[model samples]
Target chain A: MDSHSHPAPTADVATVAARWSKKAVVVAGVGAVLAVVGGLSAAKDGGFGKQFGFSYLQAFMFFLSLCLGGLFLTVVHHLFDAAWSVPVRRLNEHLACLAPVMFVLFIPILILAKQIYPWMQIADPASDAALHAKSPLFTPGGWYGVSILLFVLWTFVSFQLRRNSLNQDKDGAAIHTQNMRVHAAYGIFIFALGLTFAAILWMKGLEHQWFSTMYGVYYFAGSVWTTLATLYVISLALKKAGPLALVMQRNQFHDIAKLFYAFTVFYAYIHFSQYFIIWNGGMPEETFYYVQREQGSWWGIGMLIVFGHFLIPFLAFARIDAKLNIAVAIPVCVWAWMMHYCDMSFNVMPILRPKGFELTITDLGCWLFIGGVVAIAWLRSLASHPVYPLKDPRLGEALGIHFHDEGDAGHAPAKASK
Target chain B: MADSNIDYTVKLGLLAEYATPAELMQAAEKFREAGYRRWDVYSPFPIHGMDDAMGLGNSKVGWFTFCCGASGYTLGMIMIWWMNAHDYAIGVGGKPLFSPIFSFPVAYECTILLGAFGSLGGMFILNKLPRHYNPLFKVERFSRATHDGFFLFVETSDPKYSDIETRKLLESTGTRQIEEVRD
Candidate 1:
């Protein structure tokens, strides 16, 4: 091994804040305006409450995944004590921080629960056997309680993990790393369970009569799939802007790109498995979901998802080098994000417009609202501290891995230390 | 012995063994820096930076896997569609012959199957592997390539190579042992 060591660089907080604050203000401002416009427009549509319910849900699922999936990645990062991920881990933490924001967003859904779930307004629960059977869990009170508990659990766990990561930036203590490991091991268990239930609560409950055990996994697939897309987009943007240029290596981006490829395959697996199982069984209740999807523009979008989300990406990222190849990765990531939007749209929109595809102004507005607002919030959190985890012991190992290409190896030579 | 009357196994090259990864890496660097092309490095376990030291890019097998996977998926889809939709038209579960939905499992499975095939195919092609014997096998110390030995072997065919000079270079680079490997 050759001797080469340098102190990890930290971003100037004031500088980051100054650069991002103006953009943040504009994004959040536009988001708030569009959301309000979307909400107001929904009031004029026939069954205004119902229209808003699904439109809001579409936007809700899209952004909630940014948080949920980011949290999942963050906890697992800690659980593994992954040295390679340390440079990019803080950004993942920022995304995970959106869990609290999602909770705030979830409140509106709760207030509109009756409109969102027609069953919440059921007149004679005694007459409906299936309704009666699920009454204990589906009661307005029980459902709301579960929602609260789930978000609370998510917020607490994610907050702690991020807090630990940030704290290590100050002390570089072994204790923070050791503690996060324990938290993450359990955090993953909670994430899997809570996300499954959250999937059921948020999207699956739309048609109360229909259910699939695989429904939760389907959402899990899209959640993480979309999350990876979002991660790729944000990290690449940051790198290009030079905020993360110094701290992040080609390997970090490459590793996350590899993850994006993996989830592409995994998303297809779950997607295919769920559809095949439901189609194979041909049960009325189960088949109804696919039946609705097989019609109108929904069918076309579903096929787009199959090819766009799965096949195209699977082929695009076939090589480990694809990870480092920003040209290939950026386009593929953009496509993947588009596919994820379609995935979320396909999941929620088909429910509201069973007969055909319907595009409402509110849907567009809500999307802008969520996209801009969430991006603003994430950027704020990003600027609050050093972009990289400067104090973590693995920071050295992470920055130490070198690339063969000398073209962009502007940093000091990262001798392979292992 | 006269060159034509030499023992049947032609001289392969010099095989040098390093006691540690550092020594092997330094030697690899020296060899590459000195513009030696017909050469290779091997260790019982993978060593980081070895690829850079040898001036190698990523393996080409990834493209093989992609092509194989794509072909597998396309072929699998056609097979399922032909069997269910066109040739046989079996309507199981009232699913259309080419539901695309139902055929995905088959297509997905094929993608994985052929992708694996591609990986194996790529491995064999890139490594020029599966041949059982090497002249290096005749060197007892070279047996450690699969266990503890870290080796740098420059073929006699290399333009810069000479038995005496190569051995001297190996010795100076901290290799514990060097031996002539014969075919």
Candidate 2:
């Protein structure tokens, strides 16, 4: 596989990264201006501080999905010893590395925690039975401590994975592969615990009175679904840009698209199961969450999640060829971003804007700001490393080239062109 | 060995054997370009990309699965609505007599059950698969298809098939074995 020489890609990585970095700064600045203006405009309605708090939290959770999703992908790659994902593993690593950036961006949420979480603001927690029952985990100290711990765990896992991968590129060492497997073995447990806690504390904690055990996996299903869409587009762009053209084949795109398709059904299954159980039991505590969502335009947003998020993607990509068609894939990926945004809003925005679903300028500003930061960080990570693992053993398998070492006469020496 | 009867001398096709799956795939591609419709490649195991090499299109079984699955869902919903809401009205938990939400689990199950039935039945119908016999079965070497052989067969019925030309094509593909099958 390494014997074939590739023509350099038309696009330069450093120049592209530099250009995008400058644009990201501008985007963040512009986002700040828009957020301030939106906040001031809504001063009389719910106070500027409150509006900023809700908008920031919504944007925070939305972007966090990509990070958590990236972490899941990276961990699973090692766990399954997957060959098809070897080419895209580097991209996912950079995505997971954004955990530190997310940790820094989380400052605003920490600052506005009291404003964002009603449980924190309640004067007498002992008065409310729900708050009193869950007093240990929902307390301010517990919340902040757990939040910081989740970030620390994510950064350590992702950075270690990337470090071993980069080292392998320098010297084609099998030990790095074994090391990554170890990290993934322990990292998966951390991921499940950390993700569940983050969802429970950050989003589900908004409704302190409501009860639902399925909330964590529900958020998880949507996160990975959105992440797969983002990965599809990224892999496509990088392949066209030249760096990944050699390693990426139709096999990569087809497999990624198929995984995305599976997640679509998985997300629908999880969301519907949660709804069905709640709707069937008709418990006051569980029903209250859906009841609040049924009000005003929230009802329409819920319907959108059902149809737009589930049905459209399901039916559109039902054909076998649709997964491989670029025209069909790009549109579906873009639509996934929109649906995931609506999903995030459906989860976080209902408490703040109880009347209905509305897209505020503050929301857009926050989304742009966080997205810009993440893009710059990801691009820097991309520029600093070889676009793909240069010497990973599976690289040969991924490219459809089989290697026969010395003394391995048990296998045929035939060359099969794929 | 005195069974050389002229009455049974009907040419069914030509069978050509290649040493490996790679060569077989290359030959399949050539046969596709030659526009030979009634032909196929046989191997002990499936070769990836062989479908493309053979110029085969997507199977039509999906239509059967989709249509049957849709009917299964619709019928399930209607059956529940008729039985519970109309024929025998029984109130359970003061819920509506019929709701898609409550009935969804059953309907979804029906969809899977019928969808599976459709696929199995569709495959049988499309492949004409309760096959009793074929002229190829008479070729002793052809039985190796279930073992280690990689063979390509082009029927005499195919428009592009000429015994002389097809034999030459197989020779060009680097195969040493060729034989005719009688129906």
Candidate 3:
């Protein structure tokens, strides 16, 4: 094996983090103002409180997806003991740390739960057996309690995982790597539960009459795609700053892009699979959801998602070069984010604004509100240690990787003696 | 051409062996930039950047797959409509004879089936696989390509290929061995 490249020395982690923390503060400040503005207007506009409730849910879910997906990626990084992603793993760790902030964010949804969830407002369970059957878990109290538990679970595990990683930055002990890997292996199971339960409880619970086991996976797929797209932008920004440009290689981008592509197809596969099965059953209850979506202006948005969310980005990022090329990748990432926002809106907004489409001030405010808080927390957490793991055993492996299969021969060692 | 083909079992190409994939990759870049076509690189594993260096473009199979899927979907739609409206004229619980929502399931399946086959068939035809014979297989050392070897084969047919010039280029690239392959 070739012992070729090693990571270049870098400025202190404290210094590099200051650059991002300022941006985080600004984003948080803006988010705080938006939350206040959106909150006050919703209170005053009593007629549109229901819309605000759902819009808030939509924005909240979108931001939650990013953090949940970040946790999932961190687990995968450790589970596979991935070497290529070491430089960027800190970004994921910080996002995963946003689990606490997400916990606090859930309170808003609880306050708006009665308006958003149909089952919560049901007069009597005796009249509705389906709602009654799932009442043990989906009850308002049960829903809030179990969801809080899920977030608590997520925050605890995410915090522990980040601590283990930060500790490794201090000491390159195999034990630290080993402990985190084991923790990740099991943490994934808990994270899956959190994601699955959160998806079913919060988003799917919007229409209690409608149920699909694949709903959780749909949320998961969205999380992974959005998480990766966000990471790509962060990595691009870091590289542009001239620090990570020397330490990190383009190979990481290509690898992450490959993963982004897989999740994109996985999301479509899950989306289509649920739709295909439900449509084939031809049952009135399940089919009604599709009918509702396909009939109105929602139909237009649905078609847009099919093309924008899946087709265009799928085709654009299909190539190896496209994933590795920063210019092409950024536009595709932005498009995917737009489509992700559209996907969440399609899920949430149809309950109120089914007429066609409308982007209210509250919707814009809520999005900025959730995004700003998480951005602030995740960015501040970056300074916990070095931008890259200072003592990671696989740092060399990351530094030496070739981004593409046909990478320049100049990068490889003198020759393969084998 | 016939006389030439009849002589000496037919001259296939010049087969050059490089000690490592890196060397073969370098030779590939040199030949590609020198504008030689009708040549290929073989190694135990793929070398990064070989496709771009060889001036290869994206595969056209995606287009084939797309065409097949679109046609399959259209065909499914027509079948469902014709059977319900004309041939059988059966009522699906009084639903419209051509309800597109109900037809989506079958249309989706058909699209996937035909698209998958299109890609498989397109790849096989484009690559000319299941080929019965190639003169390069006559070389005993070539078999190591699957295990541990790197090869760059420049066909005699390439316009840039000349025995003396090609031989010198391969030697300059530090090829471990070079030989003329017979058909």
Can you list the residue pairs that collide in candidate 3?
A: A251-A403, A405-B47, A405-B48, A406-B48, A406-B49, A406-B50, A407-B48, A407-B49
Candidate 3 C-alpha lDDT tens digits along B1-183 = 578655657666888888766677778878987888989988888766566556676788877788888888998888888888789888766567777767877887898989998899888888898798877677999998998989999998999988889888888888899988887
**Candidate 2: tens digits of C-alpha lDDT, residues A1-418:** 3523443332465565677689888888888788888878987876777898888888889889999999999999999999989989998998999999999999999998898899998998899999989878888888999999999999999999999998998787899999999999999988888999999999999998887888889999999999999999988888776677677777788788888899999999999999999999989889999999999999999999999999999888888789878899999999999999999999999999999999999998888888888888888888877777877888877765432443221112122223
Candidate 2 docking DockQ: 0.34
Q: Kindly list the per-residue Cα lDDT of model 1 for residues A1-418, writing each as its tens digit.
A: 1113334334554365557667766766676676667667667654666777678888888888889888888888887878878878888888888888888878778888888886787888777665787777777777999999998999888889988888887788899999899889899988999998888877877777787778887888888878887777777767767766655666677778878778888888888888888778888878888888989989999889888889798877877777667788888877877787788888887867776666677776667667766777777787777787777887756775433343324222343211
Off by over 4 Å in 2: A3-11, A402-418, B1-4
Quote the positional error of residue A101 for candidate 2 in Å.
0.4
Candidate 1: DockQ? 0.33
RMSD of each: 4.2, 3.2, 4.7
Which candidate tops TM-score? 2
For model 2, name the residue pairs that clash.
Answer: none
DockQ of all models, two decimals each: 0.33, 0.34, 0.25
Taken over the whole model, the C-alpha lDDT of each candidate is: 0.78, 0.86, 0.79
Candidate 2: deviation at residue A58, Å?
A: 0.8
Ranking by lDDT: 2, 3, 1
